[model samples]
Target: MASESSVWNTCNYSRDVTFFYNLVGKKISEEWSTQDFVVIGLGLTVCLIVVLANLMVMAAILMNRRFHFPIYYLLGNMAAADLFAGIAYVNLMLNTGPWTRMLTKEQWYIRGALIDISLTASVANLLAVAVERHQTIITMQLHSNMTKRRVVLLIVCIWVTAIIMGLVPSTFWNCECDLDDCSTVAPLYSRRFLIFWAVLNLLTFFIMVAMYARIFIYVRYQSRATSEHTSEIRHNQTVVNLMKTISMVLGAFVICWTPGLMTLLLDGLLGKASHANSFEKYCLVIAECNSLVNPIIYSLRDNEMRRTFKWILCCLCRKGADQRRQPSVKINSPLSEETLDFVQKSEDRALRKPQDSHDKDGWTEPRV
Candidate 1:
């Protein structure tokens, strides 16, 4: 009887050990994958491109006087947000280990915070841009009142609001989750946050769409009612160009942001499954790709910007054409008697009419 009892205890111990070993082995097998390398490589490549492109956009706006306007200020803010997002993604890709290796708790927290901040900032800036455009189109008088100082204030407000949005999530929910290789966090998709963002996004999208639709409708009506005036035609063309620019910006925003929002909604409501990891990663990749897309769209669509970019590249290449394009020294030549007389007459005529400094700058001295 004693021998049988001892045998039964030994059998139970052996079964428990075997079960533990098999569980560990299954985990190890699941972690191992050849495709991790490719995914990381692609992620890094995308990050590098996005960072460089966004930086270029910021630099271009800052360095060029032509781009120094309220609209471009918003664009610069957008680029800055994108630049930060790209950097954060690069950090995430570098720190993320193979599936076999779990991410540290710190990494999880940091990534969540960074993603929340970057995404909120990017989307907020887009909304701000759209609002600015709506104001310009719907209330041209209000646009005329827009000043550099006011624009700076608007940008500051956007950053503050975005930070609040990001911080709210962190305050309400745990920002870190332990997962294999990478960390996952609960993004407290506040009903308030969701409703606010959705309304903003939809408002911007619809307003721009409606404005463009109205402009096209008006143009068609004018074209059918009477012969198009050259000035009217030029005005319509300018409106079309503006619409195209806004469309590109809106389109890129929708493409990059919608997937992530959808995924977030799914996770928040239904709880994401382990099998959905790949889909989540794909959504991230798509969102990050927007940082690269914005610069390309801007450069291709804006004529002045396209020319400036070309000139900059030519200068970098040390091309002869760039050298030949330098300003002529003859610009400083002394005016002839007749030219001087003409300038004096023009000055007298200008003094006769009340003029602002802006109008004064518009006038030029007669050429020699």
Candidate 2:
């Protein structure tokens, strides 16, 4: 028997968006079993991790002066976007879960807008990072001469374009269907809009692949410094590291987002979202999980990032053996004294070198 309040049976658009979905095949929150609650708990856990990890990266970047250059600048923007994405998942859980009736149209629209911003900003910032790396590598400049004004312009373009692409189209999501009983299930925009969005993502992905490929080829196959064995070896090593980083970034992006992206494409192609609600929900969760990935990749591979993270967090709590032990007049032996002096001298000389952050080529900035 159909529930009188169910959207499909009643043919009502005023009902909550969740009214149409068969929630995990159960009737309502009252009917959910222990396993359902467990699933909800796990989803919440993932969302929390995504937010905290990305926020940590953003905080580290903002507080540290060394990461002020273009690449790290782009990374900070990416982290901010991911952080927002993670927050959106919380809103999704509310809208799709038992509390869905509490969601308003404005809230739903904002949720959609946030997701769009997160995705587009992520893609744009990453592409910018790759392009910056390519520019520096091929030109043999440790850092590009990107001015502050140019960087601001790029940032503005990224956000503005993302808004137009992701949020503008959502304006049509009125959820109206039949005159008496309109529904939210219908696509607000045409199939072409969906295709266009997916195509833009694919286009960016392919461009990155091509850029990385060229960078690899140039670094591996051609080098004018071949006669200088040390220079050639160093150059090749730098390029290898760059390629590895890019590969990991691109790989994570594909792994995390491909499932939902494929679903979106199929929907556009078929004019229907054919997958089960459970399956589609999980696929989207997987895509949102990408929020925490780039920061993890960055912290593991970049020694400097690790230091910066530590530096940022250490102020909160300081724990060491120093407070436990009483100071004594312990004189250093002659050899120990000499070692200490040598270390101090080396550190002093290193401080004299401009731009503490740089690649092997002595650039003033570090790559993302």
Winning model by TM-score: 2
Between which residue pairs do clashes occur in model 2? 177-182
Q: Give, for candidate 1, the lowest lDDT window spanning 10 residues.
A: 175-184
Off-target runs (Cα >4 Å) in candidate 2 are 1-33, 173-190, 223-227, 276-278, 319-368
Using Cα atoms with residue i matched to residue i, what is each candidate's TM-score against the true structure?
A: 0.67, 0.74
lDDT of 2 at 271: 46
Where does candidate 1 clash, by residue pair?
Answer: none
What is the C-alpha lDDT profile of model 1 across 135-186, one tens digit per residue?
A: 6654321123478899889888877876776666445433112112121213
lDDT of 1 at 83: 89
Candidate 1 global lDDT: 0.59
